[model samples]
Target: MEDLFYFKLFLAFTVGSTMVTLATVAAERLGSRIGGLIGGIPSAVAISLFFIGYTETPQLASEATSTIPLTMGLNGLFLVIYVGLARWGAWIAMAGALFFWVALAFLVILLNFNNFLFSLLFFILSLAGSYLILEKGYHLPSTEKILMPYTPLQILSRAFFSGSIISGAVYLSRVGGPIWGGIMAPFPTIYISTLIIMAKSKGVEFSRRITKPLLVSGMVNVVVYSTAVRYFYVLFGLALGTVLALGISAASTYGIYWFLKKRMS
Candidate 1:
């Protein structure tokens, strides 16, 4: 049990760090909107569910998805809070957003929101609400490519920050049942890292610009992956299910990027 626990934590750290780094680099090279699109692709939840299914039971992994949609909905709220407070400062925005995420996630777990249909509905509402708030309300414009150069130390530090947070989340998630696991699996640690890095490197405005695109990405990518895996893992087994889910996610990501690019142009 102890060995497995450590392994899971390590895996979480690796996935969290790699995903954030890729998103950050993508933003720096491509642009914030593009970065947001990349960021929304499945990261922690994919690995989390895969490992949960591998180590535990496929059924447990499937059960763990019971609250994933609701948790993802909360993640959308997380972005909203960050962007809303961005003008104040990056630290303030990240801190405030994290507070809401932690508080609301706990509330979700306490309430035991395990119904798939309602959770899915909540997720949809969140996506729509977030779109309105960021795009229509704030009208945050997309940022140009940020020309910031990264040092090894900077990359290492950002990875450490994301890794530690996600490692903790992964470790604690297993303590409770599948519902708790589901909720914690999609914790906004990736978003927290990506937001802070982008804000600090480029500026708060750049980070804010990406929020809308990120929301769109979240709406399509995370939802598709989670929903697909909810059934795929059970029907096809862990390895095949993960591959199929990822294939679907990748295709949707391409479609989303194309749509967003057209809209932006």
Candidate 2:
């Protein structure tokens, strides 16, 4: 029954996320971030409800329900402004972007890249992520500069993040005794570093942005997932929770940009 629930949830997630991506593709001129929000809302609500249902503690449950919504809400606002000036035929731009990135992803996957792949990429992109918030006087020179220059970096970033997570997964498999230990392995380090970066970065109102509170929400689940493995011996659940938290944290950051966008406007 539990397995069935996860399977169904994944099916829904895939469908919903895909539809949202398509909406971004089809009507990019309509404002992609906004459209993406509209597209993503269904999945957000569904996943929100699922977490709300099983969350044992009242406080944690409240956090769970708001997690994805906060992300979408934040991302929506970011899109509204950043994409507001989008012109017609933006789909052509999007298609070009998609083609380039897919080819990039294929190359990363096939090459079996290493530390230069993940660690260096993280250091660099973490800086780029940092740039979006920091360096107020330094605006991106132009659209072409922002988009064109980022092509290789984008591929490198994806390869790195994916490899790091996979390495985490493989580490878990090797531990073999309890799932919680593996789940906990990455979080304390990752979360603390993220917090430092997010904390120090300027222009972001995440300090006041409480809706999704993803870093906190995600860290909570790491604990939950770890405990489930440590005490209850729910190894599989621990593994599932860690992976899910990874998705939530990374995706939700995009969500947060918008929430901040809305409030600022």
Candidate 3:
């Protein structure tokens, strides 16, 4: 049982890491908008929910799904903080953002909000509020130039780091229970990693540009995917439920990307 659990976690980690790395590379090759859209696809969320439902109970998985929107609300808070203070320095900005992430996450779990409808409402309001706070006077950079090409070592490192974060979050779900599990599900592994790299290489403005769309699109993906998983997990069982949830999430993401791209253009 123990070995099997570890194996599942390893599998999730691999999937999460690969997806994130691919998104990051795509963001580098394409533009920030495209990158943000891909980054918003909820790779970690999907992997965690499916494995949790598969290895644990569907109830626990549903409970975790219930909290994801709230957790994503908290993630919006993370981005707002990080972008607001990014001029100071990446480390300082990251520190301030993480402080809020931890605090907001704790507050949500303390409130013990379990209703899917209520959580979805909160998620929508929080996302809108956060976007308003961050989007004021925000403008995308005009040029699509790579500051630096990622070497093989850098790509591998990103994959390893993302994989480790996903693995850790899964392990934490067991220790912290479903609510805590859900709270940790949207840990900004990809966002923080990509932001740090961008900040260091491309500068704060570049990082901020990418972060705006990433947060907006990510919130949309989480809301839709979590809602689907919450309702369908028990009805269809883990495998089918996961497939349906991912399908909904993917379709939603594409629609959002189109809307966002059109609006921006």
lDDT of each: 0.76, 0.31, 0.77
The global Cα lDDT (0 to 1) of model 3 is 0.77
Task: Candidate 3: list runs displaced more than 4 Å.
Answer: 26-39, 111-113, 137-149
Q: For candidate 1, give the lDDT of residue 219.
A: 57
Candidate 2 achieves a global lDDT of 0.31
Residue 177 displacement (Å), model 3: 1.4
Q: What TM-score do all the candidates reach, one by one?
A: 0.85, 0.29, 0.87
Best by TM-score: 3
lDDT tens digits, residues 1-265, model 1? 8898788768778877887677657756776556645655776677777767765777788888888888888889989999889889999988998899889888887887789999999999998898888878888886433355666677777767756655654555567778877877777665665576677787888888877766776655877898889899899998999999998888888788777776676
How do the residues 123-232 of candidate 3 rate in per-residue lDDT, one tens digit apiece? Answer: 88888887777766444442232344776777888788777776766777787778777877777776787788788788887888776666767778877988899888
Worst 10 residues of 1 by lDDT: 142-151
Write candidate 2's Cα lDDT for 123-231 as tens digits. Answer: 3443334334322322322211000112334334433443343334233222331121122123222222222233334212321122123322332333333222222
- Output the lDDT of residue 205, model 2: 35
| Model 1: how far residue 175 lies from native, Å | 1.4
Residue 236's lDDT within candidate 1 is 93
- Give the clash count for each candidate: 0, 7, 0
